[model samples]
Target: MSQSLDIAVIGATGTVGETLVQILEERDFPVANLHLLASSESAGQSVPFRGKNVRVREVDEFDFAKVQLAFFAAGPAVTLSFAPRATAAGCAVIDLSGALPVPQVVPEANPGILSGLGKPVQVGSPSASATALAVALAPLKGLLEIRQVSLTACLAMSSQGREAVSELARQTAELLNMRPLEPRVFDRQVAFNLLAQVGKPDAQGHVPLEKRLVNELRELLEAPLLKISVTCVQAPVFFGDSYSVSLQAAADVDLQAVNEALEAAAGIELVDADDYPTAVGDAVGQDVVYVGRVRHGVDDPAQLNLWLTTDNVRKGAALNAVQLAELLIKDPL
Candidate 1:
């Protein structure tokens, strides 16, 4: 018989948090008791799980000892404050915020990293874009020596959380009525527009999101010095993430080999040449990373170009967390 475990989901009222709850139920994780937690503002609210309304309790007042595992979908502040507390209480923590001080993980790409980690593993989930990028590139890692990667990520407002989604919706409605648009969640009008910057730029002029993509890709792929550059843009849509990736290999690449590698990759759906995936039209609510538009570079057979899309909230965050949880369940640290 499967052992039932006690689980707590922090930030249960937010976008990724709510999605995590749905995925847990959908995957039928063996849960003895599920605790839904959120900030004081979100407390008293109820989220549906296993056909029941689980009332969200304030994280500040919750008891971490009650749960064996805790999934953090909250922002950095909440994670930094509570993750340690939960860990000290002997609860394994999987942080989806991408900000915690723990080993960043993508289960499909590197489940071996979890082995021999000692008891009560605490790990951080990769950023949504990093999740998609790593999954697409992992299959090729064994086939070709990837020297460099250049990517452009088109992210939706949902990446910023539910508030950003609401802001985009309000701006769209106001724009349709010809009313003045106020940019609240974003620095500029995000409705019917694109912003080149996703987060604040660093000393090297790389935004946090771009820097994170580079760092996480390296760790997930186990390529310490891989050259990677990414341009992140906030799209006008509300969900899903679309990416244009260019990979430069160390040796001459074969087109057929690349296609076969991608097609055989786990959690990747290769699209037909005549068809392509759109974030809103095709990738929403999907669990797999959709890859299409595979082609060789104009002059370099050693280089490849591919278009990829994924439901970032699911495969990128919640699903990845759940998969890691399942890994822990199968091979307890």
Candidate 2:
């Protein structure tokens, strides 16, 4: 807060990394200098920061001196290796990767959770589950206590990381070109197909990542007793994470008020026309979470159904990380 900030974007060539740069530019965040970091393969590549070209340096060569903040858009492996060094060198790290296991944060739901860090060495939720959960609960928090929530996520390829995004594009191209497919990033071909699993299978055959999503949302919402069930499926879309939520509230809630609440929610847009359910393509490059389809169970007034969408790489990953950083900068601990 005393001087212009020196910021480094680790993994500057990935999907979230590119969006992090764009968000910083679009929001005009104050920065004294910018550094782009990636693996050795992209060491000499250059990415535009503000108006100048910042060459992508290898993570091993990142100089943390004078850097006020470092956005870790890489992965857990990189964060485990570099984040501590950056913090030790006096740089605050805002990681987009799901490296920070504790203190899970969804800005709208848990802004106060990141309090008292003069230099927050790490921040960010791994996937869109927390982001989508926050948007869906915004209306219910005021109307009725969210006793329980059941959600199933249609995760986009981009959420898996840059490699998966590339796989989606490459596989799609091969399909269009009528070429034989050999999947690399994903366990199977993503084009013209869906994977009912994400991350890896656990004892019950449910993906661990999806279970973590439910756990992360519970922690962020501070509803320890909140009943949450999730089934994550990998969709072919390149961006956007969608969730179908069925919630049971404390009492009979007003549907109109819920709709209006969603409409007025900060950092969220309600798409409520007859044909206005937000689409995956619609969320690409957008910042806000989109919510729609409000319905009440006929026999149970406390039960509700809704759909939510968000740009996984933006709102779900980069933009949300930036939003947390902005909040920290405004009311520094």
Candidate 3:
């Protein structure tokens, strides 16, 4: 018989949280009991799992001690309000909201750090762009001496929330039907058009998502001062995220070695050179990051470029958080 522990999932009604529940069931995680929680407004909803539907309860009314582990998948404010209670009750926490001022981790990039954490573990998951980059780059750290990484990330509408996702669909349908479009979630029209930026920009003209990528990617790669330039654009996509990455390695880069490294790496899928991958076709609903278009700079052998894609909500958020739980349970939860 396998050892099992009680688990609680915060924000269980959201897309990522629902996906988290689905993954837990699909992976056959040893869950003795499952606790679904959300805000009062979202409570009373039911999520299907393990051949039955689990009714959600309000987070404010639920006791953290009832579960050995809890996943924080809500907004930063929600995490801030309830995480302390869970931790105080000796519940291990995996925060996907990036609220806590902790080191962001990716299972493929920094699994070793899991064993060294203090008791009542509190871990933070990296952003989507960071997670994909870490999975693709961590394998090549030993192969190439990287000095700088420049990336342009095309993000899906689901990153903004369900409203944005619904708005994109509505706008697209209206345009197809030759009807006037009205943008609700976003200030401007987003259907069939790319948005220049993702989140609000600071005084330095850098958005939160871009800054998060630069910082989280460095942490995941264990390079505190690695130079990273990231630009996040809101694509007309609904589910997956795409990245065009260029790494400036010191001296000449061995293209064959890079290809082989990515091929052997866990959580990455190497696409054939003749065919490229897209967010919708290859990455959505997939757990691994797809890597293709592997080549060196047109004239500069020191520069390496690659294209990567992954399911933002699945692999990037829910599965990554769940993978951390899988590791934690091995050491006794």
Candidate 1 global TM-score: 0.97
TM-score of each: 0.97, 0.92, 0.98
Report the C-alpha lDDT of model 2 over 16-129, residue by residue, as the tens digit.
898889899999887778888998987898888778887888989777885878888887898889988888887777766677654667677778777844554466655666
Quick one: RMSD of model 3? 1.1
Per-residue lDDT over 55-167 for candidate 1, one digit per residue giving the tens place of the 0 to 100 score: 99999998899999999999889999999899999999999888786788887787788885666889878999988888888888888898999999999888989889999
Instruction: State which candidate has the highest lDDT.
Output: 3
271 Cα displacement, candidate 3 (Å): 0.2
Relative to the true structure, how large is the alpha-carbon lDDT of every model? 0.89, 0.79, 0.92
Q: How much is 307 displaced in model 1, in angstroms?
A: 0.6
**2 or 3, which is superior by TM-score?**
3
Deviating ranges (above 4 Å) for candidate 2: 118-121, 176-180, 331-333
Model 3 ranges off by over 4 Å: none
